[model samples]
Target chain A: MEFVQNFPFICIILSMFSAIVSFILPGKAAKYLHIGMVTAVLVLSAGTLAYVAGTGESYTFMMGQFPAPWGNEIRVGVLEALMAVIFCIIMLLSVFGGIAHVEREIQRSRKNLFYILLDLLLASLLALIYTNDLFTAYVFIEINTIAACGLIIVKKEARTYVSAIRYMVMSLVGSGLFLIGLSLLYGITGHLLMTPAKEALEKIIAQGTYHVPLVVIMVLVVIGLGIKSGMYLFHTWIPDTYGYTTPTCSAILSSLVSKSYIFLMIKIFFRVVGFDSIISSHLVNIIFVLGLIGMIMGSVAAIKENDIRRMTAFSSVAQIGYIYMGIGLGTTAGVVAALFHIIVHGITKSQLFISIAGLSDVSDGKQDFHSLKGAGFRCKIAGAAYTAASLSMVGMPFFSGFVSKYLFASSAMTAGSGRLIAAWIVLGVSTILNTVYFMRTVITIYTPVDEEMRKVHGISPSKTEQAAMAAMILLNVVVGVASTPIIRALESGLAMFG
Target chain B: MDVIINMLRNHYQDIAAVFLFVIGMTNLLLQQNLIKKIIGLDIMDSAIYLFLASKGYIAGRTAPIVVDGITDVERYINPIPAGLVLTGIVVSVSVSALMMALTICLYREYHTLNLDEIMMKIRKEED
Candidate 1:
């Protein structure tokens, strides 16, 4: 039991160790070793979740055996466990989807380095979700950014390098703003703990007039996290970066990296900043406006993109806005809906990306809609999986997106945000736009082809690819059907905020 | 005038930090070359370090250190931000190295270091 209690942290350390070992090992041995390490980490994370669920106690461990307010403490509560489970599942699927694509695209010499950076990225994400201290979160965010940048440019292409550099600049600015915010909180509280920070903020708020420094700090934190979250105004780097990266790299960045930042933003907004001031001051409206813009603009831009990856990249922007709009409502149901969307979108988008990988392979990099004609019959399972995932993305009934979007719209109405109501209309229109574009691609895949064309290029996915797609599709269906239980669990976990 | 001067003197450290930050921002915005932009980023980062260190300072205080039998030791400037800046410096260095590697890759790919020319080529390719 004790071993299971320590499992999440242990998995993080093990991942880091494996990353080191991956760097040191010979090239041919490294890929297998990396997969072994990730599988082990996945098992550890599962054990941790089972232990948490069985014991119903939060697991707490102070790093370096130091006490609170000084050294970091990793807490594996229900929320952390839930996020861990999601992260591990997505990571496992990514590995499955990544193997063939990585093997084909990455140079032989740099393959080991790719695995090392990938493991380090996963390790940093796990650490970010587990830590309770805000400063520790900051450190993990920095590590995550660096590791993500490395992974993005692993192929050393000029476009990839430029996009990575742009991402780097944006991340550093965001981190700087976040640090300034933290400093302000520390100046008032004399402690860096989340609970203490909240208490201190309450005391400051009780003085009637809000402190200018605190407001400045809040704005700084929002802008900083906004960049990391790739919210509308700060999202210039996203399409270019995701467009230029490989499918596997794009999946990792989109599915995990963006969500981790959103998670941190939730932690900061609810736990550290205190929701009372945020709602009372009408900053939630500002968030809603930005999110609405993102939702509308992203979908419109995506409809115009011809490149498969770029279109998907823009779609991610719209999806992120949906999550943010839910959170921006400031209702309990809204928060839960947002968290649900984060998880569901993570899995569905990753599956979609992986399936696109198969499409890319079959089409010989001709990833346009026209080039993918009749691909459904060629690789039936992947095509079916892709269709199912895309249906979920478009919020078809009995699919994952439908549940989250329903929850979000209901919550917005309950919260009485007329702006959010209008935002919901925008979201609905965008959902239709989303369907128009994605369905175009889907239909292109299944459309009848000339008999002569079929003889020349009848590429089907391998068994592993088929299995991976099936697993992802199964997850999408199961999560859709069983969303209520997960929502209830999330509600219980978030009850502490109320 | 006297009040303004007093205010300036009172917040001298903060004023200096903000000044340096503005300079860095201007350089970053105006600079055309990639390496120069990196230099501007460093300048901006150093400004933040200065701001943090200044926030930690107290008048007539020495560096934070403990000695035996120092029961009546006067207040010292906060050491936490200094420690944080050390870590921040390391982070910035790593970012700089990555940026340099990216620039090297960009040069290799485009056979040019000028951002405008490279962007033009990319636009041409897109069209």
Candidate 2:
């Protein structure tokens, strides 16, 4: 076996090890430890991405002596490696951008605990990405939930406490449903491994037995993950959880944490139950209609929100709706578009959160539009970065968001007339709504304040924050302009998905 | 009635598990009290474990401990669901403990176990 095959397991173990090691270390040391760990994972995943993309083959690394149908295994392919690399990059940037807030907002005694949770969260996300076993994925989903809750509660405020519990309650419900679905799947297929489960499911489908149970399992798993990913109506916990938490936590939660569940759902479609079944089951139609509703309703809610953080949180609901909408199309082009939107939204949304954090810092630590007025001019770097991110979100040409929307539009063209028309209308209306709120935010931040308010001196962002913002903007533009290769990579990577 | 009776007779365990799941889900969604919500979550998790246990159990089969060194597959029920149930229990325990810890935090701040009351207090404080 090649040495690079070990990279996936090594990355998971290393992050877990860091979580444990950081628990014992002092806060300052743990911060540096996290940086070192992220950098290491970033490098390893980059190497793995290059190798996998070059070979164009997916490899399964056995976790024990048992082979395909038994024991544990993690499959790494071009898509998974690409996701890992980008996830690590975004994580490192989020930490870099939000560490100052962490130091300031959290009590000294609990600071290390924050990093511990971050490490565990990263480990769980990596495990979710790589694990081929349904049960292993469930375990990591629990770990992800717990670690994310700790991230919220680490700030030690009444609001954070309330929001954390709400988040926990919702997460537990989601995971519980997911577990029941997996157990039922096991009962039908008698296999926990994805490949074996797929084989069994195919046989069962051919035999045409247990049709009701199969559909029930599909709905359970999809809805479970949908709730976790903050799909539309299941997004009641989103705004408070994202708005009240520390900025870094919100950035990670909105971008990577919710995204992993969606990625896992996509994996299940391709690997376990099969996308053909997903389409044939008529579940995609329901997903399609819900996605359409969420796209309109989420944006409407965001428009109603006065607080900037809550606005972004609501925007996430709309973006998640777009991804599900693409999946609902149930075409290869549509799935690819959805995957591209994942990358685009992940990079663009994190950038928005991190930059907005900087913006609010210069505006008396306020997140409302009234206080954030003129914040852009005061904090030039944050302003530029925020503007760039907002432009991307608004789907302007020459931005990553535009590329994704374009992909979605073209993908919709290939669908049936009814779906194509619905997707187009929603896409058009959603884009308009996205422009309305995001551009309003941009304009508000750049709006001039009164002389007295202008006299309040704004502190320039620290060197690290400036750099993080620059890196994010650079990534956003690079993804937008040089998107051909990335899209091609996603297409080919998806080909090897199963 | 005949179809319902057949379903109840043949799939009693699954029906009961589904009933408990629905009840737990209802409580978790509708309950105003924090502790009751946690209890609801536990009930939901327990329902899943029971479902899994039922899936693993086979009538007239011994445990998978290999009694008298019997290696025959038919001598034991499927052990995968047992393992899955164990894992589910551990996850639920930790999650319930975390929920309880958060409940304590909420109680410390608001002096109430009702989520609605707490939300009202939070609104008052914010205003």
Which candidate's lDDT is highest? 2
What are the clashing pairs of model 2? Answer: none
- What digit string (tens of lDDT, one per residue) describes model 1 on residues A1-498? 376777888888988898898877876677787778778887887777677767766657877887766777777766777887888888878777767667666888898998888888989899888877787788888889999998888776767887887788777778777876777677777667676677777887887545777778777788888888788888888887787777778888989998998888887777778777777767777787788888888888888988777888899888988888887787878888889998999999988888877776666566787878877766677688889988999999878888988888788876776756676788788789889888988988888887654532534556776788899999999999889878876776566433
**In candidate 2, what are the lDDT values of residues A2-67, reduced to their tens digit?**
898899899999999998998889999898898899899999998899889888899999987688
lDDT string, candidate 1, B1-127, tens digits = 9999998989888788778876775655456577886787788778888887777778787776766555445656667877877877888788778778777888788887667778899899878
TM-score of each: 0.95, 0.98
Candidate 1 stretches with Cα past 4 Å from truth are A55-59, A208-210, A455-460, B1-3, B25-30
Worst 10 residues of 2 chain B by lDDT: B62-71
- Which residue segments of model 2 deviate by more than 4 Å? A450-459, B1-3
Candidate 1: lDDT of B41? 72
Worst lDDT 10-window in candidate 2 chain A: A452-461
Q: Name the lDDT of candidate 1.
A: 0.80
DockQ for every model, please.
Answer: 0.59, 0.88
